[model samples]
Target: MTTPIVAFLFLLLPVASLAAGPGGVPLRSAEVDITDQASLQRGARLFVNYCLSCHSARYMRYSQMGKGLGLTDDQVQDNLMFAADKIAQPMDVAMSLGDAKRWFGNPPPDLSVVARSRGADWLYTYMLTFYKDDDPARPYGVNNLVFKDVGMPDVLWELRGIQVPVYGEAGDAHGAETAAIADLALQTPGLRTPAEFSRDMRDLVNFLVFVGEPAQAKRHRVGLWVLAFIILFFIVSYALYREYWKDVH
Candidate 1:
């Protein structure tokens, strides 16, 4: 019990310790739960729908996802198997690297290990903070608070709605302009409320975390069993030692 609790805390610390990026955009805690299968499933659906068109999780396979997320082959094949021909196929896109680069001005990065590279909190905040841009270069552009002038548009705009940045004057008598987001104000109402959208983002991030290290939940389960075996062996060995000592005495 204590071991699991300790393991859980260790899992959370990376998110807990995340700091804001440049432009003073703070990170929101992701609070990803690898054990929440339902949440992960919802997140998987969201990822496949919104992100899979552009991004690829090349290292992750549909078959591996079924095992990791406790889905049956049929469930995975029917629901999550979009671009992959076989269940064992990796999560790659139909779009080639050259096409993606031409379209987006740069190739979209593979997301297989992104959660490990950029902590979950960063992803969570970035997902939530995309706003309709005011920059002249991309006046209709959708920019991210965390990564300014982000290439990817607001893919979840319909679900979470359009957010516009709330700016404030800072650090000068003449009031210099800055891209820093003081707060986010939803410009258009979406299918889900802000609270609901936050939960959806949480689920999406949770799935990413699960994909980043599919064995994490399994490791936790196996660790408990391993500890139990060790304890039982120790007790049996102690009893045998006591019996041998009794005969000697």
Candidate 2:
């Protein structure tokens, strides 16, 4: 049993390494709270306005999202139900797969479970790290620190502003000198300040986390009740055992 457990632990090492952020870059903490309804509302707005154009959340319905986020049916219908006529319909894209492939080289992936698969940290870092690139060959004139050679353009550029990479010298393989991105600098300011943009991104990540598990909050509540009942049962059982054993002793 010990040997089998040791072997299993070794097997998990590669999986842990593979979970590291892209290019071995450290991921920033999303610090998202799924219980924050206001943040989820903001994130929902951002997702619908930007991501829904290309990507679809097929597992998530407008009615479900509205109920989870404390939104009214009217609000959801008026603001979020763009691609669907009915509130019960799933959040989907208007862009066809063929058109998406032609434009983006691949169909944009469905985002219903993206938060679960990619993790909140990766998504947050990816959203924040897009910088201006002069590479003419690349479809998007932007690159990301988290995802190098990324195919998608920075859709939130208007809000986050144009950023450029600050390079520094680094030793590459074979002891050769190479330029590496040391940091990012804002080349042009956008409508929102850096602080405000960060806050909005947090909200967006928060919403994605909620979408990944809409019942998580309720589940937590149920879990607390279960634990409480278990504790109560244990106490009563112990009392009964003491009462019976006292007479026997």
Candidate 3:
């Protein structure tokens, strides 16, 4: 018969580690240039290659993306679009929600607002954090910190390879002299070394940043016009007020 203390310890152990643990990459630290045309174009290509199979930006039309990214309709159709889709149609993934759920146990979330909702940093970090663990219970023999115990596999594992984590201590930071530690370092390195992996992650993040606000260029141009109009209106109002005061005096 097992003692209650041993059972309590077993229950408490994994929970304690998971609560403060950190195996996934830190995503909130990447900085992306959304307005870089080359970067945006590269990002679009990468998205088509890696993510379009499972995820869709259902809110974005192909033509709108073409216009925003300065690509021609033919280019959007030939390169970026995977479906037999009309150029004017919104982006949709090949798989349906039901099919995705059946295969992966959950449908992949729509990416239309992921950048704005999760921010560029989180996305960037998440793309780089798929390490290999032979845990069958996890959906993909891997897990992510950005979306804990997510259903999606590390789809880019071929390029990235199996990752193992090196663990460390949290220590004194949260009060206890020997506080629980939840830090991770890379264990089994991948095909692309750390620097290359980081760059690819950045590219993906940059693309998502562009998707989040495709009209950013137009907004910047319109902003200047708006500011100019406001300044001119303020000057005219000041002159009008001065004229009225002069007549009264």
Highest TM-score among the candidates is held by which one?
Answer: 2
* Model 1 residue 228 lDDT score: 71
Among all windows of 10 consecutive residues in model 1, the one with the lowest summed lDDT is 9-18
- Cα displacement (angstroms), candidate 1, residue 137, comes to 1.0
Which candidate do you rate higher for lDDT, 1 or 2?
A: 2
Model 1 ranges off by over 4 Å: 1-18, 173-180, 214-249
Q: lDDT: which candidate is best?
A: 2
Model 2 score (lDDT)? 0.86
The alpha-carbon lDDT assigned to residue 158 of candidate 3 equals: 69
Clashes of each: 0, 0, 3
State candidate 2's TM-score: 0.78
lDDT (C-alpha) at residue 111 in model 1: 91
Count of clashes in candidate 3:
3
Candidate 1 residue lDDT tens string, 1-249: 357546644664434544566666678999999999999999999999899999998878998888878999999999988888799889999999889888888688989878876879999998998888766796348888787778887889999998888875544666655534578898899999999999999999999988889545565699789777866776677679878899788
Is candidate 2 or 3 superior in TM-score? 2
